[model samples]
Target chain A: MISAYVTLAVLLLGLALWRQTQPDPGHRQIAAGGWRQMRPLLVRIPIALIAGSFLAMLVPRELVASSLGDGSGLQGILLATLLGAVMPGGPMITFPIALALISAGTGTAQMVTLITAWSVLALHRVIAFELPALGWRLTGIRLLACLILAPIAGLLAMLIGAART
Target chain B: MAGQTGGKPARNGPPLLDGSTVFFVLLALGAGLAVLLLRGADAFNTALADGLGLLLLIMPIVVAAVLVGAYVQAMVPREAMERWLGGSSGMRGLLLATAAGSLTPGGPFAAFPLVLALYRSGAAVPVCVTYLTSWSVLGINRALVWELPLLGPEFTLTRLLVSLPLPLIAGLLTRGLLHRFSRTVT
Candidate 1:
C-alpha cells in the first residue's frame, strides 16, 4: 500500500509538472487549486477517519461479521448496498467508514457493493448535484440505469472471489 | 452553468461549508466523543492511533488525488464540452463523454455542471446518461487515489473489471428508452 501510494504521488506530480510546461494560464491554477482542495480535506478526512477507527473498535466484530460477513452472503450485500446508498457525503466520508467496516470483519463482497452503491446511487449526490444540473428527466433516467449496479457488482464479487479484500 | 466558472461570478449565494460540512463535523465529533466517554480514554487513544496509521498509509495518495483533481479541472476544455459531447454525434461522442467522465478528476461539482452544459447545448439524453454512468462506475480519480490505497488493488481491480461494461450498457438502455419515447410521441 505504501509503495503504491508513493508511486502514485510521484507519477501524478510528474504529470502535473509536465502539464505546467505547456505554459497555459491554467497550469499555475493546478497547484493553487490543489492546495485549496487539500486544506479542507486535511482537516475533514482525519476527523472522519479518527472517529471511524475508534467507532470500529466499539462495534462488535462478531456482530459485524455475522451481518456483513461471508456467512451473511447475498443478504449482507444487499444490506451493505442500501446502507451505502443512503449514507451521505463524498469519498472522504465513505472511505473512512468503509475502512472501519473492513477492520470490523466485513466481507469483501459487502464492501464492494457498499462502495459501488455510494458511487452510483448516493442520495445526496443525486439530490444535490444531479437534479439541479440535469433536471428530473435525465436524473431519473440515469438512476434507473444505475439501479442494478450495486447488487450485480456484489453477485459478481461473490462469483469471482473478489470477496477477499 | 453553476456560476462558478466563466470568470468567478458574484459571491451572492451560501458558502460551501454551510449545511453538509457542519453536519459531518458534528457527526464526527459526536462519534469521537461518544467512543471516548464509553470506552474510556485508553481505548479512545488506541482507536485514534489506529486511524492515524491508516491515515499515514493513504495521506500522500490523498494529497496526490487532490492535486490530480485540480490538474484535471485546470486542463479540461470545459467550454468546448458541448462540441464533443453534444449533437447527433453518435457512438464516438458517447465514447468521448464516457472517457472524459471516468478519467477526468474532480468531484460532482466539476463534472455535473459540465454535463449539464453539454445537455443544455443539445447533447442527447443517452449521451448524458452514458457520461454520468461512466463517472459513477469508473470514477478513475477516486478509484486510483482513494480506493487503491484504502481498499487495495485486488478489490479495486475486481470492481473495475466487473464494471467495465456499465457505461455502454447504460448508453444502450438509455438510447432504447429515448427512441421508444420519441416513437410514442410521434
Candidate 2:
C-alpha cells in the first residue's frame, strides 16, 4: 500500500511537470475542474465505505463462500454477471460493494465477472446514455455483440486461477 | 467536435448533492443504524473504524487518480482523436478505436457523446462498437482510479489480461452481425 502511494505520487509529479511544459498552461482551470469532478466522489466514497463495512458484517460469510467462493465456478460467474448488469450508479457504489463481497470471501473470478458485467452491460447506462446518444440500432447491436464478454472473462479468470493453484 | 469540451463541466452538470449521493447517504445511515441496533456498539465501532482505516489507506491514491484524470482530460486532443477515428476502417480502425477508447477519460457522459459523434461522422459501426466496448471494458483512467486501488494488483492484472481481447472480439462480432443483417435486408 505504501508502495502504491509512492508510485502514484511520482506519477502525479510527472504529470504536473508535463502540464507545466505546455505553452498555454491552464493549471488553475484544470485544478478547479478536477476539484469539481472529485467533490461529489469525496462525499460518496466515505459513505460507501461505511456502508460496505456494515454490509460485510451483516452478510453471512457462509452464504458468500458457498455461492461465490472457490469451486462456485460457472454458477457464481453467471450470478455475478446478472447482479452486475442490474447494478446502478458508478465506481463509487460498485467498488465498495465489491470490496464488501471480497471481504465476505467472494472469489476473485466472481468479482471479475461482476465488475466486467457492470462495465460492459450496465442496463442503466445503456438506457440512460447509450440509447439516447447512439439510438436503438447502434446500442442494440453493441449490446448484442458484447453480451457474452463478462462471463467469458470470468471463465478465463477461473481457468487462470485453477492453473496457478 | 473540434471545439467540444471533453471533461469540462457542462452547463447542466449534475449538482454536488445529487440524487445518487442522497440515496447513498440514506443507505449508509440505515446500515449504520442496523449495525448499531443488531450487532451492538462494539460491532458498529469496529466497522466504522475499519471503514475509516480503509479510507485513509486509499485516499492518497484516489487523489492522485483524480489529478491524473484531470490532466489527461486537459491534454487529450479531442479533435485529433476524432479525425483519426473518422478516417479509419477495418481492423486498423478497430485498433485505433480501442486505443482512443482506453485513453479517453471521464465517465459515460463524456464517452457516449464522443462515440455518437464518431458514428454520425461516418465511422463504421464496428469501429464505434469497438470504441464503446474499449471505453467500457479497458478504460485506463477507470483502472487506475478505481480498479487498481480497490481490487489490488493481482486481481486487476488478471481481469485486464482476460479483458484485453474483448473489444476486438466485440467489433468482429458486430461486423459479422451487420453483414448478415444487411444481406437479409437487400
Candidate 3:
C-alpha cells in the first residue's frame, strides 16, 4: 500500500517534470538557476560518501546493534542518534542496519531516533555540504530541532506500535 | 534551448560521479573485497544479503527525487510551497508550515535546491524554516521504504500516526522564533 503510494507519487512527479520541461522559459530558467546554485553540494557528495564508507568500516556493527539494540530506550535513542550522526552511513546502509538492529531486539523508539538522525543530521553531510550551503544559523537551528524531535518521533512510533497491537 | 548557452550542468543529474566518482567506485569495490577476503565470502555474502534490498528500494527514490528535483526546477513556484497553509496569524501559520513540511522530499541537501527556488520565487523566512525543519524530522521517503520493512506493519502505522503531527510543532516553534528575530530587526 505504501509502496503503491510512493509509486504513484513518483509517477505524478515524473509527469510534473515532463510537463515543466515544455517550451516555457520560466521552468527552464528555474532549472538552470537551481543547477548553478547547487553545484557545490553536488561536488561535495562523493567526498562525503567516501568518508562515510570509510567510517562505517571502523565502527563495528555489533557494537551498534548491541549498545542501542532493541532493548534500549530513550538513552539508546539518544546514543543512536548521535552515533548515527557521527558514524556516517547513508540510507542504503542505515536502513538495513536499522532493520537488523530491530531484529536484534533494539527498542523501536531508539531505532526511530537513530534513523531520524541518520537521515537528517548525518555528520558527514552536515560537515561536507549542509553547513556550507545553508549556513551556521539555519544549520544549527535545524540540527537543534531534529535533536528535540527525533526522540519524540521515536517515542511516538513506539506508542503507535503498541496501540495497534 | 534559449538558455542552452548557460553551460552549467543540471542540478538533478546523477550524484555518484560528482566529487570523486571513480575514486569511490574503487573504494566501494575495495571495501567489498576487503570483507570478502578478511571475513571470507560468507561475510561479504551476509553484508550484501542484508544491505541489497535497501539499496534497491532507494534506487527508485533517488531516481524520482532527481526527476522531482527537475520539476521543482521548472514548475512549483517557490512562493506556492511556502504560502503558509494559514495566513498571518502566528499559530495558524505554524500549523500550515508543519503540514507543508511533511510533504517535501530529500534531506536538507534535497531541500536546499527547493528552498532556494522558494526564496527566489518569494517565500518567507518562517515558512522556509518550517519546511526545512519538517524535511529532516519527517520521513515521507523512509516511511515508504525503511520504516515499513524494519518496523513491521504495526510499527510502521504507528510511526506515520506520530510523524504526521511533528512538522506542525516544529514549524510553529521555528516560525515563532524567526518572527521574533525579524521583528527585532524591523
Q: Is candidate 2 or candidate 3 better by TM-score?
A: 2
Supply the DockQ value of model 2. Answer: 0.59
Query: Highest TM-score among the candidates is held by which one?
Result: 2
Instruction: Report the candidate with higher TM-score, 1 versus 3.
Output: 1
- In angstroms, how far off is B130's CA in candidate 1? 1.1
Residue pairs in steric clash, candidate 1? none
> Which candidate should be chosen as best, given DockQ against the real structure?
2
- Candidate 3: C-alpha RMSD after superposition: 7.6
Q: How close to the true structure is residue A56 of candidate 2, measured as C-alpha lDDT? A: 78
Angstrom error at residue A19, model 3:
10
Off by over 4 Å in 2: A26-29, B1-14, B184-186
Candidate with top lDDT is 2
Docking class of 1: medium
Query: Among all windows of ten consecutive residues in candidate 3 chain B, which has the lowest summed lDDT?
Result: B1-10
Each candidate structure's TM-score, on Cα atoms with residue i matched to residue i, is: 0.84, 0.90, 0.62
Q: List the residue pairs that clash in candidate 2.
A: none
Predictions in order: lDDT = 0.76, 0.84, 0.57
Instruction: Indicate the docking level reached by candidate 2.
Output: medium
lDDT tens digits by residue: candidate 2, A54-144: 8777888899999999779899999999999999988878887898899999999999999999999999999899888988999889989
lDDT of candidate 2 over B20-134, digit per residue (tens): 8778888888888998999999999999999999888876677778878888878877886797689767788899888888888888999988887788777899999998889
